[model samples]
Structures are given as structure tokens and as C-alpha cells.
Target: MPDATFKIFRGDRDGGELYEYKVPIAPGMVVLDALHYIQAHDAPDLAVRWNCKAGKCGSCSAEVNGRPRLTCKTRLDALPLDQPITVQPMKSFPVLKDLVTDVSWNYRVNKKIPPFTPRPNVEWKMDQREVDRVQEFRKCIECFLCQNVCHVLRDHEKQEQFGGPRFFVRIAGLEMHPLDGLSRTELLKEELGIGLCNITKCCTEVCPEDIHITDNAIIPLKERVVDDFYDPVRWFLRKLSGKKH
Candidate 1:
């Protein structure tokens, strides 16, 4: 019924600025709807990305009032409308234009991890509990909000080093699979740089799927890396035996 002001970021990778707009609010309106209104009424050049506005596609992710969220799922009334609703592209990725970012780096990191390969000559059968464990990680919609919130990726700019939480969840799904034979500990340690995580749980908090990126995925993977590389007794034994596996 009343007009709400929005400070939406506009620009390319080289430069940008938050531009203000006024849109009349409607009952049960979401932030995405407001942005669409702005596009129709004010700035036709406004760039934002969305597909399934029902929140299943995860394509509408953006920082609303500086918090990573799916704009389609974020309710306008939930925010303080008296203040300008600040919407910006995810800080973790380079901006392509407006709220759409270049997320191709996430794909490239994903390709580095090995695909799921079942153990040779083993039964394909698995317990329901095991299936349930990996199933949690599988719920991810690739919103990349977890990745965007990760300080290792967002603050430290470890794109060349860390795989971020999304891939860690993927690696966790593979590593925890009952039939999966291949070991990604080496890959996790060397390339993905799981050690750099520091168990902040920032990734876990932002995940739209409610996947436990820290407790279920990252901590266990960290433990495996520590055992494989950092255990002093094991290292000593390996040196004594002069064996490399």
C-alpha cells in the first residue's frame, strides 16, 4: 500500500554504485517482486537473475541488506522498510552486471574433483542410514550462498586455493558414500585446501538447504586430512617402515 525505497547496486565488474528506487508495496510481496516492479516502473536497464521464483532454482541469490539470501524467498515485510533495502550481488564472486555474478569459477573447481566411482566387485547395496547421511549433502541447490559467506573465499580471496563449502559438501557426499572407493583426502588437502577452513561454520549458517557444511562435512574431512598427514605417530611409523601408500 505504501512505497518502499530500495538501494540496488548497478554496474559491471569494473565499477558500480547503489541506485535508489521507489516501488509501491503489495500484500505478501517478496524482494524479487519489488525488484521486478522497479525494473518495470523505474530503471528498465536494472539487471537481476532469477528463474524459479519459488526458491527451488537458487538463481535469485543476492545480498539483501548485506545478508546473502534468495531474493525470491525473502519477504519484504520481514525487513525494515523504513530503511532502504540494500540489494547487491554476492560478494564472493566477481560481478558480471548488477546482481548477476560470474559463477563459472565454482564450476571449474567442481570439475577438479573426481567423479563418483564405485568400488570394484563390491555389492551396490547400502544401509538406509548411510544413504540418509549422504542425502543431506545432496539437497544443495548450488545457491553458492554458503560459498559466498565462507571467509576463506569471500574475505581471503582463496579462489585459487580453497574449493569453498559447496564443493566440500560434494566431496563429503562422495567420501562418505558406502560404495565410493576413491580417496579425495589428498585432493581435499592439496587443491581444495580444506585445512584453510578453520571451522567457522559461516558456511553452515547460510546454506539454504540446511546442510551441515561444518559439522557433518568440513570437520570430518579435516580430521581425515590430519590423520593422513599430521598424526605424529603415524608419520613416525611411516618413516620407520619407509613405505609410501
Candidate 2:
């Protein structure tokens, strides 16, 4: 409708500065479109990580209007485009130059998850009813938007201790397996630091797939961890049985 000014943060692990750019507005342009136009015409050096601009790939995640959102999916018309649009790299990760944050940390954390080691020689055949539970986890596109919005990692900078919400979905898919039974609650509690999440649901708010990241995934795992370690009745039963589950 009118001219739009973008105050974009530009820089990296070493150092950088915020640069402003003006671009003519169109009827139905998204934020990603504007960034691409700027990169093509004005700022050729703009380093942004975006692929599958249809919002399937989660690479182009950044803070739009100070909220962690996928740029490709956010429409400019949805915002107050009459003013300067502030676009910045996700604060949770190291800036890699202009709107692109180093998300390699997510891949590193993903490696720590134990693989689904199914039982020995057990012919695994799951009914749709049983398979339906884990299918919800399939909706996740590995967009680290949830990871960035999580205050434990974003604000408090607890990546060394807390794994963030993305892994909760990861752990949930594995831990909830009907046949593949492994006690990761201990690993989640001690090694991975699941206790750091305070159920703020910030992760849920930014999820593009609308997966119940807190209620369905993280909270259930937390309850399981509590039942395993903290429940007095379960502790007594385990002691009497002389067995650990």
C-alpha cells in the first residue's frame, strides 16, 4: 500500500551492525519476498538461510516484529506495514550475518537422542490405533522456531543445560513407542535437563504445525520423569519388587 522501511540487523559471531533499507510495497508480498528483493537489488551481501519458501523447510526462522516466526509464511499485510518493519536474526543462536543465525547447535543436540532400538527379534506390527499417538509427532518439520522462543534457551541462555522444546517432540516420539520401551526419563532428567522447562508454552505459541508441544509432548514426559524418580508410592513398589523399570 505504501513505502516500507526495514531496520535489519546485520553481523556475525565476530561483529556487525544494523542496516536499514527501503523497498516499495506490493499488495500480497510476504516478509521473505521483501528480504529477497532487498538482497537482489539493494543488499547483495545479505546472508539469509531460506529454502522451500512455501514454509515447509524451517531454515528461515527469525524474529519478525520481535516474535519468532517463519518469515516465508508471515504476510506483510498482517502487520502495521505503514511503519518501519524490524527484522532480526533469532536471538537464541549466534548471528551469521543479516537475519541468518547459526542453527548448527540444533543438529548437534539432535544427535544426542537415542535411536529407536526396538526389541530383539520381536516382529513389530502396530495397529492404526496404536500408531496414531506417535503420528502427531510426525507433524513437526524440525523448524527450530520453538527452540528460539523458549525463554530457557533464548533469554536465560541455558542451551548447555536445557535442550529446548524441539527435542521434547523428538523424545516424545521415541519414549511413547508402544513396543520400543526405553527409560529415557532418567536421561531426560539428568543428562538432557528436561526440568529446565517451566511449562510457559512459549514453544507451543510459535509452532507452525500447531502441535501441542507442551501439553502432549513435554508435560507428559515431565510427568513420566516425576513418576519414575519422585513418586514415593512407585519408589516403594520398585523397592519391594526389587526391580527397576
Which structure among the candidates has the greatest lDDT?
1
Position 116, candidate 2: lDDT: 88
| TM-score of each prediction | 0.95, 0.96
**Model 2 misplacement above 4 A:** none
Q: How many backbone clashes does candidate 2 have?
A: 0
Pick the TM-score winner.
Answer: 2
CA error at residue 162 for candidate 2, angstroms: 1.1
Q: How good is model 2 by TM-score?
A: 0.96
lDDT for position 37 in model 1: 93
lDDT of 1 by residue, 159-226 (tens): 99999989999999999999998889999999999989889898888887788889999998888887
**Candidate 2, residues 1-245: lDDT per residue as tens digits?**
46789888888888876788898889888889899989999999998889999888887888888988899999988989777888899888998777878788988888888888787776778878878998888789887999989999988998888888999898999988877866788889986799999999999999988899999999999999988999999999999999786
In model 2, the clashing pairs are: none
